[model samples]
Target: MRKTKWFTFRNFFHRSSLTSSMKPRPVNAYSFVPFSPVAMLDPTILTIGGVVLGIAIIERILERWGVIDLVDQFSKVMRFILPVTFYGALFYFFATFMF
Candidate 1:
């Protein structure tokens, strides 16, 4: 007598009901609107102004403590240098890539 393949395979494994018990659930819609990149100036200006104000405050505090004179000199140089450097870089980047 020959043994069948189904009987041989059935002896090797046991079945479980755990897999059929679980079901996927749907996600709810988002409650808030997405951000727009076009109106960037308002936030950018506010952020730059806040950062400059904070740096000025910190420099004043450091000056009061009589720390190194480097901060004052660097600030003086940066006052003239930063805007020029920023605009130059901006123009170069845009002119090279955009136009």
Candidate 2:
């Protein structure tokens, strides 16, 4: 005797649902750490420095490639602006979150 296509499909879904329901539900994995302003200061500075360095490197690459005159000019402007922006943002985060 041949099983009908609909019967096989229905059985597949039913079996899957049964097995899924029998398995234990997953536990929540997320854990939060309490924030410490003093602990964060050094890492925050280092992160800002890293970000500035990365931007400078990318700008240098763009200048080397000579892709667009506008990008080269923008890169030059950003070299000074990016550090200031990152530093300002860091200050803002500390001010808002820590204080």
Candidate 3:
């Protein structure tokens, strides 16, 4: 039996609403981990994450194609620490200033 477009959409949304309401039940051993913010809210973050992931991926592809290699094979632990701290501070600053 063929379903009407409206019935199909209604069924989809109804199923989504049911799923969204289900509590954070553990699906596996480590399933107690909190839900990611990106999963619970606006798709904007997901879209931005997709773009950032794409750029990072393309950068890798370009590096493979003989462009300047930005990533190091052996980076010091501090390499990640510094930029993350800087970005965290910058994000806080902007969040405070703008909001």
Candidate 4:
């Protein structure tokens, strides 16, 4: 005997019936409309922002502390830096069009 699974979903009671049962009507429609830009932000943007900031900060701090000796080694970091700037530009295009 499974007891009919309790019928536990929120919508088991119809809205009109819910109105009668509750006396005062709770809500006419859904309350909150989320703001546009924040909603527009996709996962990739957040991930890139976090990763780029973290890497740049670490690189700066390392450079400041005199840890990386060879100035030529900065060439490797510059590779990543250029593409990050390009990614920023593409993201701007996305913001302009898609969002």
Candidate 5:
């Protein structure tokens, strides 16, 4: 009798030929350790964080300066553009790198 696709797939994961030693342990089996403060000071992360904080501060300053029209227009454009750009980049990355 021919096995179904599901049966074949299931059997692949549960093959008796695989020894217990070869099986990977569950994530919970490992103890968790918090990152040291020094290890967390990654330059790339700090640079990205600084850029975001700078943008926020600039936006606040623009708002305080009463450039409502310019700010609103820029915000509206960014609201639409950012998502499209983000999704386009994400799709491109997955299409090229993942598949």
Candidate 6:
């Protein structure tokens, strides 16, 4: 006599009764209200303003602690690095278009 297995490949792959009831429904993309440009820009504007304000406050604090020389040194380094980075990025961007 041949021995029978309880779990076959088909039985193992079959979904239970619980999962079959929770199938996903189709959705329309434009279900919500229409877009507003001002509403979108409000958060972006506030974020930029906050970043600028924070930088200014940090600079003021550093100056108060007599880090003017350090700040000047950093500015000198940034003057060189910024241009090199900008040109390198621009070269890569243009290269992408060419290739």
Model 5: ten consecutive residues of lowest lDDT: 90-99
The alpha-carbon deviation from the true structure for residue 5 of candidate 4, after best TM-score superposition, in angstroms, is: 62
Who wins the lDDT comparison?
2
Error of 2 at 1 (Å): 99
The lDDT-based order of candidates, best leading, equals: 2, 4, 5, 1, 6, 3
| TM values, all candidates | 0.36, 0.37, 0.32, 0.41, 0.41, 0.34
The regions of model 2 sitting more than 4 angstroms off are 1-41, 76-80, 86-99
Tell me how far the alpha carbon of residue 16 in candidate 5 is from the true structure, in angstroms, after superposition: 54
lDDT of 6 by residue, 42-99 (tens): 5544565565566557666877899999767656765686567656655654454321
Candidate 6 ranges beyond 4 A from true positions: 1-66
Per-residue CA lDDT of candidate 4, range 1-99, in tens?
A: 634435446656543342443357576775374346664466666676677677667778878888776434765876878697767857764676532
Model 3 TM: 0.32
Worst 10 residues of 2 by lDDT: 14-23
**Candidate 3 residue-wise lDDT, 1-99, digit = tens:** 955444477677566453353468766566565545444244544455565566567667766876553444313433675477557655654454421
The true-structure Cα RMSD of candidate 5 reads 14.8
On the 0 to 100 scale, the lDDT of residue 48 in model 1 is 60
User: What are the per-model C-alpha RMSD values against the true structure?
Assistant: 14.5, 16.7, 19.8, 14.4, 14.8, 16.3
Distance from true location, Cα of 70 in model 4, Å = 6.0
Clash number for every model?
0, 0, 0, 0, 0, 0
Give the whole-model CA lDDT for all candidates, comma-separated: 0.62, 0.71, 0.53, 0.64, 0.62, 0.60
Where does model 4 exceed 4 Å of error?
Answer: 1-35, 70-76, 88-99
lDDT of 1 at 55: 74
